[model samples]
Target: MTAKWREREKTGIRMGRRRRMDMILFNMVREELRGRVRRLKPDWNQLFDRANANKSDRWRCW
Candidate 1:
């Protein structure tokens, strides 16, 4: 599974997808930015915080 994931990443398969490809990357970038804006940042679980926050903030326009 690790090799497959690495291959997929190298092949750009995720990026080659339709709307979801962009959305996934956009969400990742947004999460990264949000984490950076805060002080006394999270230790190793920042992605968890971002994922949790992403789940609750689903907007109607989205």
Candidate 2:
């Protein structure tokens, strides 16, 4: 009923909205990163295999 109480209520509503927006944005970014990692998993595995193979070849040469 008072001015101070109204201002506090408004601020609380704004904070809640901002929190929801942050959560949505975070989820969007997380999903994007997950998709990217999924797409790159095969490439990452291939590179890992190649590195191991190259290391073995180097040891053989030594």
Best by lDDT: 1
**lDDT for each residue of candidate 1 in 9-40, tens digit (9 for 90 to 100):** 55564555435545875787677768777655
**Residue 8 CA displacement from its true place in model 2, Å:** 13
Where model 2 places Cα greater than 4 Å from the true spot, the runs are: 1-15, 38-62
Candidate 2 lDDT, 11-53, residue by residue in tens? 7557685465456546755666676775754344554454356
Alpha-carbon runs more than 4 Å astray in model 1: 1-16, 38-62
TM-score per candidate: 0.33, 0.38
Model 2 scores what on Cα lDDT?
0.52
